[model samples]
Target: MRAAIIHGPQDVRVEDVPDPAMLRPSDAVVRVEASCVCGSDLWRYRGIRPVAHPVRMGHEFVGVVEEVGAEVTRVSPGDFVIAPFAFSCGECVHCRNGVQTSCVRGGGWAGTDADGLPVDGGQGERVRVPLADGTLVAVPGAPGDALLPGLLALSDVMGTGHHAAVRGGVREGSVVAVVGDGAVGLCAILAARRLGAARVVAFSSHAPRQELARRFGADDVIAARGDEGVAALGELLGAEGADVVIEAVGTQGAMEQAVAAARPGGNVGYVGVPNGITALPVKQMFNRNVSLLGGVAPVRAYIDELLPEVLAGTLDPGPVFDLTLPLADVARAYEAMDRREAIKVMLRG
Candidate 1:
């Protein structure tokens, strides 16, 4: 088996590694059919997250179950499945409350599990999926390659974007503005419209992303940054600002813009993996009565809800993947994303 290992910043190599095997009764081994680089993965790739030691890469994947532990009954071998970025036990209190990301027994990919067993990353040939019953969602029947991208999107960005929309309180006839134009932000536009937002605005400076934003249902695109961006949003939505603002970039500036783009009493649903943010505008938020909501999206909780739509072909978030590469070219994928030459990169196993 081969998996991507990040020896250091800007250094990702696909090398032969031990194959994944179930270590727990709740675990399953999945033969990854498709995987992709995530925006969050760039944090480590760029050294912003620091790679003190080499670690496996990737957290999003769609695969086929090759084997399951004795306790796994929800899925059997050969079942096509989508693995969320984080693994969780569905029986936990937090999971029951629809916060699977905070499940008492949950953990992330490519890290040691509770029992100290190594978990393989999705960017590999196979992955040992803990909490199989709770973490893997099986797709019905055989889906062709055309649906792979959309199905893969469900593994993270789509669900994360939906989380942003839900937390922002998007509803029928709501006016929404999304900060950042990354894959997650683009999907946020789709999620907002799917939730019945009447007018959705996207803030993007890139031409390709701007086009994708419109395709995803953004009614307007504002190519501005900082206070100017907020003013642009205000001009578009009037002095009241947007009814809901979704922040998908994890930067101090992006967060500030998100807060400023919302009307007093409006919500800001942020799903960006925070990078350099050190403080919040507590006093400003207090004075304006603006609410800041959302965090690392519990994508596992939204998979089942979004899976049907993806399988139905009604919701296609696949277009966000503008680049595709073989697993062996994993480093190239990272470089493409780092250079902003690709919106998102999909890897075929």
Candidate 2:
């Protein structure tokens, strides 16, 4: 099997690796049909996030089951499925309560019994999915080739966007402000519309992302940054702030802007992987009664609900895929994203 091996920063190469086999009664091996280079993948690619070993480097993927363990009953060898970025044990307390991302039995990236078997990432010809029953969702039928991108979005980005809206308590007629224009952020904009947000404000400086954001349902696109951006948001909202602010940038600056752009008693739903130390003004939050609630998006919890929309073509997130490359050219995908030449990169395995 040829997999993308991350030897170090900017050193992802396609190399032959041992094919994954079913190691447990709950395991399943998937022949990856489509995968993507997520924004988080760039953290390591740019050396911001460390990769100590040449581990598998992607998570968002859709594939067909090649083999399944005896215990895997929900899906069979030929079923096409979308694998969530995180694997969970459905029986765990967190998972039972619909918080699969924090399932007590699942651990991400760091491999261990907690994470079950080391599942190969999607940026490869094949991948081993742990806790197959709990992690992979079988699509209704063999979807069209065009639906692949949208289906693949459900694996993580789209689901994460839905999570962000859920966390922010977005409802019809509510004003939502999204801080960031990354893939997840754009998806967040789409989710906000799906959730009935009357007005969606996206802060983006890039022309391509701004267009996508508006197409996704952003009523207003604010092209400013820092305090000026916050003021612009205030101006757009009639001197008030948005009812809900979704933070998808995952940086301290983006977080601050999100906080500043929300009205009193609003919610800040964040999904960006925080880069180390983050500073939040607790005093302001207390005085303004702002509720800060978010963590790693519980993508698995919302996959079922969001999947149908993609299948129906009511929600098209495929626009985020500005660049699609073969598995062998994943390094160039990373470079395009890292240099901001592309909004998001989709890789076909």
Candidate 3:
């Protein structure tokens, strides 16, 4: 099998790796069909996030199940499925509470499996998926070629975007503002519309990103940043801030802008992986009665509901992929994303 391995910053390669097998009765082996490069993957590619050892990369995928462990009764060998980025035991306390992102027994692509075995990640030709019953969602039929990208989006980006809206407590006819125009943030714009937001505001300076945000349902586009940007948002909302704010960027500037753009007692749903050491003005937040609540997105919890929308053609989140490349040219794809030349790169195996 061939996999995408990152040897160091800006160095991604497609090389042969040992084939995966079902090591436990709860496991399954999936033949990769479609996988995309996520914004999080760029954190390591740009050297902002360290990679001490060469390891597999990529966490969003839709594939075909080639083999399954003895205990995997829900799916069979020939099933097509979408594998969530996180692996969780369906029976955990956190999972039962609709917060599978913090499940006690499961971990993301970076953790151990239900059987106490390490899980093989996405970004490969074939990989072993542990906790099959919990992580893999079977599609009723093979999706058409055109629906591939949308189906793939359900695995991570789209789901994460929806999580932001849910966490932000978006209500029908509410005014919502989104900070950050990355893939997830753009999807949040779409999710806000789906959630029935009356007005959606997006803050972005890039032309390409801002255009996409408008297409997704943003009623107003603010091109400024910093204090000017905050004032622009307030003006757009008739001198009042938004009812809910979504912070998809983890930087101090982004966080501050999100808080400043929300009305008193409003919420900020943030899912960007924080770089650690973020400064927050607790005094301002306390005075404004603002609430901040969000972290790693519980993407797995939203897949079932979002998948049907994708299948129904009501939502098309596939435009997030501005570039596509074969697995062999993955290094160039990584560079394209790192340099901001591509919004999101789709890698086909």
TM-score of each: 0.99, 0.97, 0.97
Q: What Cα-based lDDT does every candidate model obtain?
A: 0.93, 0.86, 0.86
TM-score of 2: 0.97
**Model 1 residue 140 lDDT?**
94
Off by over 4 Å in 2: 109-116
lDDT of 3: 0.86
Give one digit per residue, the lDDT tens place, for model 3 in 1-349: 8899898888888889889977878888999988888888888888888989988888888889999998898878889899888877677899888788787878777336645676666888987887788878898888887888888888888888888898899979889999999999999999999999999999898899999999999998999987899888877787567989999988888888888888999998888777653688677789998889878877878888988889998998988888888888899988888878988888888
> Per-residue lDDT tens digits of candidate 2, residues 181-296?
99899999999999999999999999999999999999999999878999999888885679999999788888888888889999999998888645787788889888888789
Which TM-score value belongs to model 3? 0.97
Which pairs of residues collide in candidate 3?
none
Alpha-carbon error at 255 in model 2, in Å? 0.8
Angstrom error of the Cα, residue 77, model 2: value is 0.8
Best candidate, TM-score: 1
Model 3 ranges off by over 4 Å: 114-116
Ranking by lDDT: 1, 2, 3
Q: What is the lDDT of residue 220 in candidate 1?
A: 96
